[model samples]
Target: MALASLAAASLPTAAAAVRSRVSLLRRAMAASPSSSSCAGLAGSPARVGVVQMTSVGDLDANYATCSRLTKEAASAGVKFLCFPEVFSFIGSKDGESIKIAEPLDGPIMQRYRSLAKESSMWLSLGGFQEKGPDDSHQYNTHVLIDDSGEIRSSYRKIHLFDVDVPGNMVYKESRFTTAGDTVVAVDSPFGRLGLTVCYDLRFPELYQCLRFKHQAQVLLVPSAFTKVTGEAHWEILLCARAIETQCYVIAAAQAGKHNEKRESYGDSIIIDPWGTVIARLPDRLSTGFAVADIDLSKVEAVRTKMPISEHRKFDSDWKTS
Candidate 1:
């Protein structure tokens, strides 16, 4: 299917109308506290880092870039750091991704786990090319690692990028990647986080499900968005998700040319619940990270005033399992 068709099909009906309703913000607004992996750092502000990169087919080189960025974030006192999709490697040749795919417990991931432990920080390894069921395919997995270096949760990419760009560029991600059937949410000191990959940002219903069903207070969109689409829809789509879901949206992105055939739009950004851009890289092509403080109070404050969850009249219509 075409990109427009896929987008139109995935989106739910226009958001439900708001009704007059009042409810407890903490109790009624966000994800279940019980579902969180750790205690909520309620009153405190947690610092986060969003790393942007220009990854290529070289695994060792990418690892080195990530290490430098991680050290910089640690020096800035960031507690949780996010890396973009294809953080480990972006293939420059056909069959390279599938050839290099590894399991979650493989050496590549283990190295990243060690990095998190050594840095004493939580890590969102956005997209790893996990070995799939066959020799020709892989799973684009988004993994969350705790500060203790244990795997917290993993979400595979549900929405694949299979679009035809105007500039004679066509992507068929499904050709070599399997779509994930699960929606994953996990607890962190920051809040309950909804994990999604690059193309997933185009769909609002997923974000709604996160806010309503999973009670996600923060959303992670780790992407290697193409330069064309990123320039057009990336930030706007991110801000829309933040405002509509009443959640913080953290996007770590791939910037600049990765290989001869591909280039990414870099502008790693953090948006607040009110649709405000809090932190973004000034130089979009720079291999660096952006820092911001995640204030749960602000998340509560925004949802309390709006109370969209309680006021939504078509709750049954758009609710997802």
Candidate 2:
């Protein structure tokens, strides 16, 4: 459809965005009229912030950008802040990724830990290049830090994005990135939260296990999605997981062209249980974030109303017996 014709379709979406913003405002007001922090606001479970970034090969530059954004999130009373994948660095070539890979407790994490401590905000380092066993491949890891600057949980990118698209667009993540074997969930003030990285967003089963089996209230998907794929599948995939799991979906994304080789799509978003895109950052390439108030009550409300997990027909669970 032409741009004018598309307006009709966007009308409802515009209305929905308004509603989401209003809902967030009301929730924020209810918890604390003036404060945005969990400490400042007594009753709120937590106020979360999601960041969208244009990261490049320069590690110091990326860190500086992240630091500025982190300060902005803290100023807004964001108690929990999540950043896009490859927050530490996004190199020019595939091989350069392994070169910059660092250990979990390396300087990168230490600096992020300090940021978390300074802001008094729980930080989710969406995706980092953690040094693997050999130089051949590194692990795309997600590290979770508590407000006190302690590492809480870390999940490696389980499903690598290895695809050969038309127009000679080819990506072999497995070429330099090792895959993770286990699913991970962590406890937070808000509730149990499940963690996953970019390509893992493509698999619904991972989310199913996180919600139904692991009992997660929130699902995290930190991505550096390709522009083409992200434009086509980003929102749909996010809403699907939120609706099916009845959990809040928090996705932080990398935006803009990182180098000559790659460009990312970023409409960094946080969707509610009923598949409503409650909060979203700009679709254009830039650095920004969207904050949302997560109420565990809403999770219970949605699950109670839909009861999809309770009504499953077949068992997809593993039996040790």
Candidate 3:
């Protein structure tokens, strides 16, 4: 489908009627805490908080920032929270990163687990450099921690960001990280969540499997996107994924200058099923968060109205199950 056509399809419908109904629903939800999640749908919407950060080599400082952000999100009544890729730490060099890589059961993760229990909230720990089995190549691993602080799912990033730009910057992630081979999804309060990391944003086939095969309702793209590419393609790609898959897309990002050599484009966003940008944040050094109400009804509504999944034609040769 043409991008313009999808944009036009999502324009306001019966504007006055929708405004009035939304106002009433908000009022009702504010009055009852227990019923807030399901105010406008059969199943309760998962209220999500996306945390944006600029993490460097200081593990303790990153933890403090995350601690403050997590506490604030918890107070705001969010059930689940997601942090940017490499939320744990982003070192100045690949050698430094390899030196600091930790196991899933390391002290850093233990601290995160404790924090999750303290806040009584579920957390997507985003991406961290995990020590590979052989201890030579690292894995860009993402972990999903439940409300009770149990590790529910872990996905190693499949796409290594190997890019080059003349007179700009060149990054060959495969030199330091081993690519993963699995398509992972986990069941959560929000819905079934399809997991992918920074460079995975460029590949649409992986997302298709998450939607069609795994029946994922939400997709998480935690990233440390370069400023150049992010400016050009970030929102466009994020919205396209949401529109094509008919799923909620939450992208927490590393924003601002992390070190002397690198900076990230940080327009962190949460997009809905119909490609509507619900919440967003500008690039900044300070830690910040934006919350979005995740209603599966909206996903179903778009799918029912468009029926694109049923209309797909080139399915026989498609891979990535």
Candidate 4:
């Protein structure tokens, strides 16, 4: 069966597991707003910001770019701000990523945490090179920090980019990056956010689990996609996920050339549950952010009208025991 079709098919065990897990998450993250609580804000809209960046080998320079963007978003009254993958540093040479990998409690993350508190805004540090279990490998981790400078939740990118595109580029991310095993979702004032990195966008099953099982209303895809692939499939794939999950999708992207060998396709976008592009960066490779109002009522309205989750059927052959 096609992966897209498989995503629509029922996965009873996965659904149950996510339900049980999110229940525990609610108790743990007491600061997180509930869906019922967010209903009260239907009269008002929460503003979100997505940043498109061109991160290079200089760590300080990359941090400076992020800092500037954060200030801009905060000044604009953005409640939640998301940065692209490798927002901190995209190395110019091989093996540089692992050399600079740091733990969640390290100085690099501490600075970001402080930035969130100082700006008085929730931040999704879309992707960071996190120190993994082994010395030689790192995890491409996505971190969520609340306005109060607290770590809300983090998800390591599960799907690595290990493809040799016909004639464009050859990326073997798995060579130095350790794959994460778990799926993660978190609740916020905006809505429940389903966290995912670049390559994960290609897998719709993850989005399905987040929407149907974890009850995610917004999906985050932070990527540093190559120019070749982004031109062909980036927006198409992102819109498909939003349509399939019936959820809002926010994609923060890295744009322009990172180094001599690395270049990205930058088109940061905010999409509604109906697959409409609400906001996007005008200049593809410019370091900037696009802001949009995230209305949870829209999510509720769409799902209510369609009610596909309740109507999906399972093939008898694949039904769980």
Worst 10 residues of 1 by lDDT: 1-10
Model 4 error, position 234 (Å): 0.6
1-321, model 1: which lDDT tens digit per residue? 000000112222223211111111223234433353333645588899888889999999999988887877888888899999989999988789999999999999998999999999999999899998888999999999988889999998877777677663778888999877667888888888999999888767667777877788999999998887887888889999999999999999999998789999899989999999988887789888888888888888898899998988764488787
- Candidate 4, residues 40-97: lDDT per residue as tens digits? 2355778899899889988899888888888888888888999999999999877898
Off by over 4 Å in 3: 1-41, 282-286, 315-321
Cα RMSD for candidates in order: 8.3, 11.5, 12.9, 8.0
Clash pairs, candidate 3, are: none
Consecutive 10-residue window with the lowest summed lDDT within model 4? 1-10
Scanning candidate 3 in windows of ten residues, the lowest lDDT window is 1-10
What C-alpha lDDT values do all the predictions have? 0.82, 0.78, 0.79, 0.82
Clashes of 3: 0
Q: Kindly list the per-residue Cα lDDT of model 3 for residues 24-122, writing each as its tens digit.
A: 434433352231121224677778888788888999999998888888888888888898899988888767778878889988888888889999998
**Between which residue pairs do clashes occur in model 1?**
31-215
Candidate 2 on 177-276: residue-level lDDT in tens? 8877667877788677889998777667678777766778889999988877776788898999999899899999998888888888888888888999
Look at candidate 3 and tell me the lDDT of residue 107: 86
Residue clash pairs of candidate 2: none
